[model samples]
Target: MDEIEVEAVDTLDPGVARDTAEYVLYGGKGGVGKTTMAAATALASANDGTATLVVSTDPAHSLSDTLEFDVPSRPARVREDAPLWAVEIDPDDALSQAGMFGQDGGFAGGLDSLLGGAAGDTAEDAAMMPGADEAAAMQLLLEYMDDERFDRVVVDTAPTGHTLRLLELPEVMDSMVGRLMQLRDRLGGMMEGLSGMFGGDDDATEEDQFGDLDAVKERVQRLRAVLTDPTRTDFRVVLVPEEMSVLEAQRLTDRLDEFGVPVGTVVVNRVMEPLADAVDVPDEAFVEPNPEGCEFCSRRWDVQQAALAEAQDLFREYDVKRVPLLADEVRGEQPLRVVAACLD
Candidate 1:
């Protein structure tokens, strides 16, 4: 992680090896190639004969589109006998199972009864609040992490803002669960007292009522630990060669650092060709037939050059991988393998 000068290349270098990290999370601004990077990495891992599961936590769920395969909530193989699997998490289903409307019918149902059947809108609103999708996605990730099915997990996260919020969820949820547990205990104590006086069983059964809350709290703690552990987890950022993209990447890099997550590499996607350097001709002779032949390409190439330079300066301390803009859309395993080759 030294400050090294990075020059935009036509292809990507083999940055971080997949087997080394149990969980690799790719995150950045939307349309910055996060899904593409994740797909390529997973494809490479599968080619290496390692079992890999690529999970899409982004609600938009474009991993299916990128892979040109139908990805279900449960892991499905991308090809016959392939070691690769992919899934777009069903967020709403995950939330319902783990949220207040869970099997226990615990908090939400209780509120509905307490409010004399006026809890419909309130319960819906609770689910719509921020972090709901993150919590649900976390639950899905935890299940995969605990399963012995995949050797490694690659996460294609949501956009920058949503991804940051998701990363912060563990801490926020832990505190909230702790307070709720405390209140449940207090209520259980009073219930036990009343039951004893009413000649009911003296056993304190109410303590078991908060089992769902305890389960959620435990899962959050485990995920938090894994995320902060540098050896097991690495956060790789993806971005386009643009001023705004670089600034957002800088902010994400700083925030991940503050959260104790290790960022191994930054992938600068869709880098324009070095128009001047790539052409082998005299400056004067290259005029009309040059890369600046068209007005649009000329303006774009100029902007891209400045943004690329800025990215190098801003992320000098991290490994930077550049992916060229392909004329053909990157889709399916074959296309992803081409990208994987660039990454290699």
Candidate 2:
């Protein structure tokens, strides 16, 4: 495979900017610094005077700690610019408001009860209800897409498995139907009237016979346009300098191509570059505190450089950013700004 190398930027030029990035999503393997990177991107958007919401979809939320402030499960202001907001969406709320065939009657409460008759064949076998999270998260994104209030929506997403499902949802909606409730609703409502008015043609197909929400399908297609359009939505994948992380990022790019979601960039976080004019490591031996009990940070960096070579080989068509390791935990505005500078 061909390879092209890249250095992380301090400020990205408009030449590489997405023309209509109303929605941007960050996804990759767990523990790859996606939350911090996504927060920085959203912060930059806000600094540019666009109203932006950076939402965390990771089951283990890091946004509250990252911002060094309280972020509500609902959307809340995290800083000075009225333009920027932070939220960690409640997955339960997304399902209830998703209006699943109106079975829940659009009530924000009581979705589990409402899902009574809607649970299909595979739901029972799904481990810890994986499919439910996909539905709920997609519903949340769809709800936001329908609303005109927010200028930009930046998602700090769950890991690749569920995140892929969330992005491909609108494309796959055509197949999600066991039965088209919209079709049945229309045909049942005016069956007798339409049959008489249109002259009971014997060879008519179901689509020809339907009259309700002919416009609705088009609307869903339009929504799909925003998600799949290259210049509109950018999917950024986060990776580290490790074997599995590099391989996973390569696989995810293939999947995104299959689903037709454009990848704007690849963010490779936590690099340990040799110093040009700065303080060196105090000792040659491994001697740092292991907060998560990961004692070999230098060894991790060695593995990462090899992985970075692999990433460069895999994503030659796209931009790959290398974010250096931070001295302290990346919390609050200062660290986030540091990261934003690295994304250029």
Candidate 3:
């Protein structure tokens, strides 16, 4: 493979600035550096004096490792001098804490009592429902959006498939809530008749059960609105410099378009660029690739350039940013700052 010379141009744009959107979401296939990008963006936003909270929705939880800090299940300030916070949401814990399945068996128990079943069976069934964990995670996300303490929220979403499900959850959950409401109405007359015979008031219990459902529906609606609003949310798709990753990102963007979500940026991670040209650092930190002499480096560089061309053309309508392949693992604040500078 011959040394291929490609022009380097600054791709960052003000429209996709870190502080432009109140909620910024980074998502793509696994191992494409989505978590690192989210962390760097959040760090940059906070350093600029914006109160920013970075939340991780990935079940494999790497945000804490990437940030080099212990992130609790709930939002906590991670830096004393900066207005930055982080949270790694545990889906099951979020659901339990939200009282979706309380000791009194909130949603599940209520439905079981109305339909006549074992006390815990309904709760178990609800837990087993498809996308239940994602739904719970999204519920917590909605709460965080309503949180007035932070000026911005950046999300590190799960891998491709899980992310699609999480994005689709609002509509799925809304339909489920609507069905439950209809079922309650259908059983309303029967409940009134039974109350008259048994001399018991079920109205209060019914009201409480349906009231929670109504609240959930309202929250889901709000989430949908925020997701579709370009000024409020910016969904950025991250990908490596590879053919498969670029194809996956294209599909993800298409799905987002179908869902009416606004995708404002595409991030190409680990591009093969000279270390000196990529980031400013001490001389010791430089580890430029010898593609001209090494056969393996030359081949990999050629492959990456091909994929980069495809990605650029496919995502031409959106702002695209590239991060150079780093010699060290991007873990601590210093390295993250370097990545943030690349983003700028």
Candidate 4:
């Protein structure tokens, strides 16, 4: 076994590792079965009778597809063993919600409407500006992660870059944001002040009443504490049995360590095996994934298996898990249930 995988395996809970973590963060490179795994894990937890919320933060969303449910703000109950709610948080919706808190013509609303709408998408202006989506989601998450909400949250994060952006934001307030802390609430309204600061006369909107610079700072701190508190957030990295996934997993490990989030384990998915050719098959090339007939199909299976075993060996230093590739995509309760059973 590789050193990294060894370390990761060591972190395994003797019995679910239940107390060590409350919220679980699943993230990795794009297209590595993360969404499926996150949904399945949430399903498992919810089945165990804990109130669970499975959330997707990825811009290029696939949670709905994976769950086979229309999860567009409509929290679908995937399992009845317990109360399980799933939400695909739309960043645009968050921005609109944030706008309601701003004074009429307030900087928060104008900026929010601007960010969540056209300007956020028009690559002609600049593709990176939609970063506000990440911020907006983080903002809402921070504001709502208190004791009143769900019991445990399962966060399906975006691809590497965007996930890193979210990680970086928690510390922004503690950095050099003294001016932000000085802004007032109630009598001292920054959003309202911002609208007028830009030389416009307008009263604050309903949404503005909920927002305060101090509240924002506090919110960031709360979220940072929630996610970074080692005992609260358990960060799991997912990868497929391929060179690119392995490379990305290693870097993700470094980033998690750097950010102070606890590393849980790595999941290696989609390792295929040899199939019998209808005509002539090698005696040694017998494996259950049995075969999708391509010219070099057997060799392809060998290479994939080799890569996966190599990953297991290479990342032995951390917790490493192997999941055979499913012949069909897993969607909805039945498939998710199958995955949970496999994990068991």
Best by TM-score: 3
Query: What is residue 311's positional error in candidate 2, in angstroms?
Result: 1.0
Please give the distance, in angstroms, between residue 65's alpha carbon in candidate 1 and its true position after superposition. Answer: 1.8
Error of 4 at 44 (Å): 1.0
When summed lDDT is taken over every stretch of 10 residues in candidate 3, the lowest stretch is 191-200
- The per-residue C-alpha lDDT of model 3 at residue 123 equals 42
- CA lDDT of each prediction against the hidden true structure: 0.71, 0.64, 0.78, 0.62
Compute each candidate's TM-score over C-alphas: 0.79, 0.72, 0.84, 0.72
List pairs with backbone clashes in candidate 1. none
Please give the lDDT score for candidate 3: 0.78
How displaced is residue 9 in candidate 2, in Å? 5.4
Candidate that beats the other on TM-score, 1 or 2, i.e. the better one: 1
Residues 1-344 of candidate 1: C-alpha lDDT, one tens digit per residue: 11223342233233223447889999999988999999999978877778889999888888988999989988999977668899888777776655433433244344445445544554444333355546667777889887798999999998998888878777666665675556446554432332221123446365444555677678878988999998999899998988999999999999999988999889888865422332222233222212436777667666777888899899989978876666567787655765565455
Best by lDDT: 3
For residue 75, give model 2's deviation from the true position in Å.
Answer: 2.3
Residue-level lDDT of model 3, residues 1-344, one tens digit each, is 43334334243221223568999999999999999999999998888888999999998899999999999999999999889999999987876655443423244545556566532433454444446567678879988988999999999999999998878777766775676556657666433322211123446465555566677778879999999999999999999999999999999999999999999989998887744544346544434567879999888877888998899899999988887787788998877877776676
Off by over 4 Å in 2: 1-20, 101-130, 178-220, 274-298
The number of clashing residue pairs in each candidate reads 0, 2, 0, 25
In Å, residue 317's CA in model 1 sits off its true spot by 1.4
Name the Cα RMSD for model 4. 8.2
